[model samples]
Target: MSAASDIAKDHKLAVFPAFHRVADRKVVIAGGGDEAAAKIRLLSETSARLVVVAKTLSPASEAAVATSGAVWIDRLFAPDDLADAALAFAASGKEAADRAVVEAARAAGVPVNAVDRPEICDFYVGALVNRAPVAVAITSTGTGPVLARHIRAKIEAMLPGETGALARIAESLRETIASVFSNGTDRRRYWERFFSGSVADALKLRGEDAARRTAKELIGTREHTGRVTLVGAGPGAEDLLTLRAQRVLQEADVIVHDQLVPDAVIAMGRRDAERVAVGKAKGAHSVTQERINEILVERATRGERVVRLKSGDPMIFSRAGEEIAALEAAGIAYDIVPGVTAALAAASSAKIPLTLRGIASSVVFATGHDRHSNVLPDWANLALSGATVAVYMGRTVAGKVATRLMAAGLPATTPVAVVENAAHADERAFTGRLDDLPELSRRSDVDGAVLIVIGEAVGEAGANAAEPLAPLGALLEAA
Candidate 1:
């Protein structure tokens, strides 16, 4: 077979679409009539310097030229007017004048558009949906102008007004993106998320500043290699999640979530995302912390978008520090997005304020056990400091916490509130004196995560608070 015959044949086009750089370049219009005005109107959207050469100006052309920043020359068209121009429009209405302008443009090597006379034109102007920095052009190569305009209208309807804003933000981050992602594949993936993912949505709904901020955050997260994000799952409630946390979940390639993280929250991630359940409960460790760290580093090293989804705030007793340290040691890019910790959710569900103006001036968060599973050192001293103390993961060490607080001068009659599965549909709350805290924490029906609150601030939540509050929808309807 001949070399040319071996190559597959491709369909040919009557006219190929091409975008020419015209910013700050000269554009000449030979007529000052309705046709020329229309072309000028389109060119006004660009940064091109317009020069209008005509013996007489119609009122419509005068108005268009005035607003379009075009320099008007009150004289007949000449070949010299096309000098240094990137484009020329011949719209004098008279065939003789239009032909002359087209001939001059061809001689000067300038592409000319002859309005309503495509046969003599060098290029046909398409119907444009002008979202600057993100334009969509529709053309039928002069064969069907009306059809191209109809297509342009459909596209205009589909795109948001803020599309240009999103495009401009992406353009601004081009340098940063180039520096962070070394390979073309990584760079392309990064831009795919920037345009079609959360950043693009943020621009349309929240405005430019929010979109730019989100774009920067996504850019800072992963690098040439894969990276990990430590996201807080927020007390087992999907709605309580921070916007940033939700965004990361949607973009994650692999989610390493805790066993306690509700399925509903995990379901918010991409449908095809890999889920690795490494949940650790009381004495049973499904995946050790060290192994979890190794998993994060390994997946990230392979250029995967890994999300270490933890229950509650990762910064507060969720062992996020160890994971962060491991990632840092391995030289992987990582970021943290905090969520609504259990203490805050528990207080909100029980209708007990963690800090009251005069009753409790300050609030403290403490895990019932230290890293070694021993009673937290000096935790009782914190309870005696006239501050509301919220204890996390304290179901097993509730008695120790209560006994030590009492021994350290905190009154035994102090109010205590315990919330299990806070903010979830099956949430439960119990309120009693400090001496009864151990019993409250050990309830057989409380199978979910537990949070214990001790101080005068919780005095108003009665024991009957165990009755789950009305759903938020019901409360809103009642209001």
Candidate 2:
């Protein structure tokens, strides 16, 4: 395998699947409250046989059970009740009881879902969009179900009902397709194009025959050879990703992404896309970059549409230049898709303006590379004019950064913000003056995609930090 193929495996983990199947299998629901009714409603279209065992079932739940003829134990469940279950769901209010049921179910080789409790879940009950043969699910990994449901509704709105019709038609004609495209790679390539285009739109506009004809055209246009696209994964949030990035991910033959790319971002690619995780964590070299650049260039030259998913905009300090250089040298077709970098995410989350009108109009982004030479950037000439300066991967060397800035005549008390794991849940931001930066960093745990910003713009943001953002948040602020 080429070096690019290996790096592709390392950086591709961002597009992992978020859903799986347990079709025509038995699942045990051991609860009596309204929770059981909700779970039953969700499973109404699924193939799983649901058994509800509770001391006292709600009247509505009992009615649902009666209508479905679902087995109701009408009492507490024993550990052995899970023996034949492929999956289990428990919603008992008692934490201890939920834990016991979850442990028992897992011991029985059954995946368990405890309602609203992340600690007890073996898997998760995600938000869903049911269109049969084409069901879609949106999950928050149990962090925010309401948010998940809202997002699922949006996704459901985006998908046309014709998608289900298209899926059914494909299934009915599967034998013929398999025979026509004998090789698995060719078959995959064919479907990748078929699903990518306006087949559903064509079927809605005309009929299945027209859609089939279009699918054939797509198959002819696609080569079975593999290609790699070096796409920026855009920080750690799925929403932070660009439309172009998602479009590429959907078409990616293989994805090599940074580890800092959120798990949710990785799940954006096609369900079957192979994902690899390369450590792109700032300041830590896990997969030496020479190998990654070679991987992208080699894979693309082979006619593969490989996506190189970085943590942020590929152009910003992200070795996009090096990879593009290799691709250009080899005459491979590729393009860069910009994304929300960690600095922007951090600045927005911390409510610090890297640049603001009058307060600090000019912004500078620098690394700590001058430390070995004991050289401080000319802060007086570059930053003394009230500009915001953002330092990427400079939190560990905060003391040196501050000393140089002070020497350059920037205020010792210039507002500084240290953001860790920007745009992610449980993200922490430390705000202080340059003088107190080192002590603040010591007291906090800064890990995973850290960034530093120093300037008066941060202080100006503090003036109206509580106010609502302007209509042009993306333009006015970096969020």
Candidate 3:
């Protein structure tokens, strides 16, 4: 088995880092040419104390310098000139001088932006879809400026100018409004309710007075409590998790997770949270379902928020129904946080859509590892059907399923895709004819989070696609 660290290095999707906004800060533009003038004008819109340093200034910049009385050092910019600045923009003579200014600014703990030179820039200037306080910045990691500007323009079209005005009005009343609710929980709920209501937009449109009146009329004195959530952890990978599932994981306290959940996702939980393992690796389920039930009930009964983290989405084949019934029977409050089912995750990682236009429109999720069930699946209803079929935990019985399915009318040449460690960084995919999938899975190095796909959709394979496996059982359950 590959180490988790190795997986992190592989199969990882791109994540964008957050950038701090320069709402009000000192900025120095170290030139007086048109480039410097443009930078200066943009800075003027902010609260930055603008300083322009250039031997010869542009007509526009010279006019601003004359009027505003900004200190224009009418001499060559020395590297030491940036000693006491917050941000520096250099568009001066010679690459050597610009490099010097950048190095000096770095030494002085100041951010420097070198015009048209991304390597020397401490921060890239992004195109803004401005709602002022609620502005959206667009950047392409310094690769595509035009693309970023285009995206900004698209965003600008959707966001109204009134939104900025509204944000300022909201900001003005924050101190007074914040004092009304001292409890952190109440404050969070209050804002959530405010944003969801049409009245928040009205406050932006009709001004603060209308918002205050509306808030008073609608909001009551009772404390609004946040809810405890129960979420599916997925088989292992963080990438396999649903967006909604990730959001809940990021917010919850006292996460009671199964052993199958990936540590990477657990790391995303609150650092101060109580993480108790309910059981592990699925074999014979170390913690019985009844015991897990008692834990969830007891924790939730105490008013401490709890999340029952099961690998994969809890709804499919998972006994979430029994748990939901338990929570209801115990009168304990809870909500379901759906996760990407193992089948979906595997399919996604394999780039094979479970459903396709005209080829396979309907999909069924079936279980493969039912130890107690003597009956096999309905071959007549399932075989050769024009639908994507996903089987969960069907590794051992995959060949048997394929053989029976083919005998029942499924063509021997039908395409099948099998994914091992689906959505995990160590994920590997195999594809082949239905007849050969069982052997492929047997030979694969995959040990966990396996899923099988069988349908005409498999025939729609693109380059760089996975091979196959006999994973009909788990796929059956997942569907």
Candidate 4:
């Protein structure tokens, strides 16, 4: 089987996930015990008009009904109780009574959930990580509910508390966005930026009024021309990506990325965004630079928000200048969102200071390979320069780099650090003398991205110096 098909097979779900629009709709609950009260607490947060049928009401159940403003019927549940209801919950705490209610609800063509009874439940109430208008329900197919709730708690902790407020603001501004943009794509793009960018920050730091004002200003100054945003994807970790980069990704109508950009990073873009891999490796070019430039211009001229996602910071050896020149020549509007370069991330991950007072007072970021010219860079000057050197795209030429540095009168025993897949879960770092640079590069198992750090400051901060970084899942939980 094909890989996608195999994945699909592996993910065969026990229940199809869906959300019901129950606002201003009728819902029925049959019970009066703690079980029934629990269901009432869950549903009370929504706008559903609830009716409770129970022979007896415990203090907890009565209080729940009062708080939820649900109608109470002091009698047994009947088939007609489910009539015209969007959903029905059975929690009488008796097997026979629960079964009767479930059957009646099903017969009335309403989905039913029986508390603590999965077999009879047409649907289960999953643990919710509620950021209203953005609720995330976690389920385990009516089994392992405790585990689901545990997972939900973890998710809840990761989300920004003000996300719900931001969602509410977005809801209130939907009509305004639609009116301003007209096109669905444009409207979506605008909101994506608003949610991930300064508007969301304004909402969090100031208030809804401030956010609304900002939104209005953005709408008034909306750019009609297609634009290209050169986004830095950061060093193999989604969390390392900047808020502006995330905003641009979400707003893009098309994403053109390098092969080094992680799948998780690309997945941050709009679900409907077109993804094109125009990656260039050392010897192999899946798509040429000229073609890439043409594609950027083509997409922009068609009025699409184009995001050129480059690994690490676009300004640092990422060939962003060429793309910017292309956009300028074509008269297309464009901007840049800087990302955390791999060098900094590598240094941070390895707990190595890029520059230390007295020991290393300066830092130089240099690429080992020059794509435009075959002539090697001034390696002697770079080696002799009394500064820390962070080498980009140097893995293939590690031996040559070491040889040149050594020949330039640098000590063979200069501290060298190789960080592979910086800031990622499987990140690996190797620390040794400069003489072992080539061997370290060869030994690295990371197929994603590699960065080499050479200087006296390499292990000055000590090995494994920084606190472990959070994984991509933690970063995505907020979104």
Per-candidate Cα RMSD to the true structure, in Å, reads: 14.2, 13.4, 9.6, 9.8
Instruction: Highest lDDT: give the candidate number.
Output: 1
What ordering of candidates by TM-score runs from best to worst? 3, 4, 1, 2
Question: Mind giving the per-residue lDDT tens digits that candidate 3 earns over 161-252?
Answer: 66675566556656756888788877765655454343465776787678767666544644333335778777676655666566556556
After the best TM-score superposition of candidate 4, give how far the Cα of residue 93 lies from its true spot, in angstroms.
6.5
Per-residue accuracy of model 1 over 1-479 as CA lDDT, tens digit each: 76565553334566778887899999999998998899888999999999999988999999999999999999999999988999999999999999999999999999998999989988889999988888888888888999999999877866768878888898899998999899998898889778756688688788899998888888776644477999999998887987778878887889999998999999989898899999876788588889999999999998788999999988988889899999999998889999899988898888898888878888899888876889974766666777899988788778888888888889978988888789999888877678776664455666667888899988865345463223334336645
Compared with the true structure, all predictions reach lDDT values of 0.85, 0.73, 0.72, 0.83
* Best candidate according to TM-score: 3
Off by over 4 Å in 4: 1-38, 51-67, 70-86, 91-111, 126-139, 144-224, 237-251, 262-279, 284-298, 319-340, 344-389, 396-414, 421-428, 438-449, 455-479
Candidate 2 C-alpha lDDT tens digits along 1-479? 99999999876632234555657677788887788877876776687787888898888788878776678887897898897787888876667778889989878888788887886677777788887888777776677788998998777766766788788767866786798889997886666656654565488899888987766565456564444566777667887777767877887867888877777998898777778777655577678778887777767666666888888778887778888787777777676788887778778888787877768778887775563644357554677888788887676667777777787787876877777677777676666677766653354345556787888887755432222211233224533
Give the winner by TM-score: 1 or 3.
Answer: 3
- Residue 353 CA error for candidate 1 (Å)? 1.1
The 10 consecutive residues of candidate 1 with the worst lDDT sum are 467-476
TM-scores, all candidates, are 0.56, 0.55, 0.61, 0.60
